[model samples]
Target: MAELIDVLLFAFLLATAFYVLLSRDLLAVVMVAGIYSLLSAGMFLVMDAADVAFTEAAVGAGVSTLLLLIALTATGRWEKPAGHRVVPLLVVLATGATLVYGTLDLPPIGKPDNPPQVHVAPHYLERSGEEIGIPNVVTSVLASYRGFDTLGEVVVVFTAGLGVFLLIGGPRRRRGGEK
Candidate 1:
């Protein structure tokens, strides 16, 4: 059942991605992108990463969709034609091939002797309660053990939000032409 769900979700994701790539209308593309984000969040949930799923749903589906809609309102809906596509297509293919090749180095999921589990995870599970005094192991790992990484993620999100706001938000009007 789980495998079936995963297959279905992945099929939907591929279909949505193709639609997004082919669609000329910006609004339709934005809607399809939102669907892709929601599907991604669902995949994360299936992998037992509720925190990541929540972030994906909120940032990818909610905030990103809203921002894209605002930007679309400012710009035209249909995409404009470009002079050349061959070079860009080649670059994209090369990048995709590189990414696929890189994934070949990853260890199988949930392997008992995985480096992370062997080295880092056990120490965190054993010491989190004592050192961090957190009742929940997950909370301790996220808040205390991996605090810098969590903070960096927050900073990146905040910076992206600020950039989007500056892009879509026009300058404020002055009353009575005052400086």
Candidate 2:
């Protein structure tokens, strides 16, 4: 049943991705992007990463969708037609092939013999209580072990949001294009 749900969610995500690529309406694309983020959040939840799922729902679906909608309101709702370019298509195909090939080498999920499980997991499980003094290993891992990484992620998100808001809401120049 869980596998079935995963397949269904993956299929929906694929369909929405194709729709977003093919649709010319910017508004529809934004809506589908929001849906994609929601499906991603669900996938994260199913994978047992509740914190990641919450962040995806809040930042990906909520803030991103609102920003895209605001952008559309400031600009136009319809995408202008563009001439087909072969280089980008080739690059995308090459990158996708590389990613698929790379994934082929990954260890199966939840395997105890996996590198992280064998190495990092034992260390964290054994020493987290003494080292971090946190009862919850997960909390210790996130807050103490990987605190810098988490802080960096937060800083990046805040900067990106501020940059986008500034770009959209910044003062407009006169018709003469003066500063």
Candidate 3:
């Protein structure tokens, strides 16, 4: 049943992606992108990645969609045509192919003997409470072991929000038009 839901969600995501790519209407594209993000959040939920799903729902579906809609309101609703697509198309195909090829080298999902499980996971699970003094292993890993990475992610999200704010024309003018 879970696998069936995953497949359906994946299919919906693919269809939404294609629609977003083919549609020239910016509003329609933004709406479909939100749908894609929602499907992604659902997929993460089904995979038991609640934290990731929450981020996807909040950042991807919520913030990103709102920003895009705001930007669309400021800009034209139609996308301008490009002069050349061949180079961009080639680049996209190459990147997609490389990603698919790279995934082939990944260990199968839930494989107990995988490198992370064999090496890093055990150390974290056993010593995290002792070293970091955090009862929850996930919190320990994110807060202590992977602190820099988590900080980097937070910084990126903050930067993106700042960019959106700048794009949306900042704060409203005062009654006296003071700077």
Candidate 4:
């Protein structure tokens, strides 16, 4: 059942990607992209990465979609027509192929003896209380054990949000009030 759900989710994600690529309506594409992110969050949840799923849902589906719609209000719903470009297509195909090939070397998921499971997770589970003084392993890892990495991730998210806001001509206001 879980395998079937995973397969369905992947199929939906692929469908959404194709929908975004083929559709000329930019608003529809953005909406579909948001759905894709929400679906991705669901996938992460299935993979037992609840924290990641939550972030994806909040940022990818919620904040991004809202910002895009706001941007669209300034720009328009339809995308400009473009002729087929072979180089970008070829580049994307090559990059995707390389990524797929690289993933071939990864350990099978959920294997007890997987490198992270064997080395890192155990240490966190064992020492999280003593070292981080946090009862919850996930909280301890994110807030204390991996604090620097988590802080960097937060910074990146913040920067990206700011960039998006700037791109959308954030808060256009007259001397008196907002336009």
List the candidates' TM-scores in order: 0.84, 0.84, 0.81, 0.84
Q: Give the Cα error of residue 49 in candidate 1, in Å.
A: 0.9
lDDT for each residue of candidate 1 in 62-150, tens digit (9 for 90 to 100) = 99899899989999799997788999999999999999999899899879898888998898888887899977787788888899998
lDDT of 2 by residue, 1-179 (tens): 99999999999999999999999999999999999999999999999988889989998999989988987998899999889879899999999999999999999998989998987889999998899887878778888899999899889989988997797656665644863
> Which wins on lDDT, candidate 3 or candidate 4?
4
List lDDT for all candidates, in order: 0.91, 0.91, 0.90, 0.91
- Per-residue lDDT tens digits of candidate 3, residues 1-179? 99899889989999999999999999999989998999999998998888888889998999989989988999989999889999999999999999999999999998999988898899999888789886778778898899999999999989988997896556665644874
Candidate 3 clashes: the total is 0
lDDT of 4 by residue, 42-132 (tens): 9999999998999899999999899899989999999888788898999999999999999999998889999989888998998888887
Q: By lDDT, rank the candidates, best first.
A: 2, 4, 1, 3
Collision count of model 1: 0
Judge candidate 1 at residue 40 and give its lDDT: 98
Better of 1 and 2 by TM-score: 1
- Candidates 1 and 3 compared by TM-score, better number: 1
Residue ranges of candidate 2 with Cα displaced over 4 Å: 129-136, 161-179
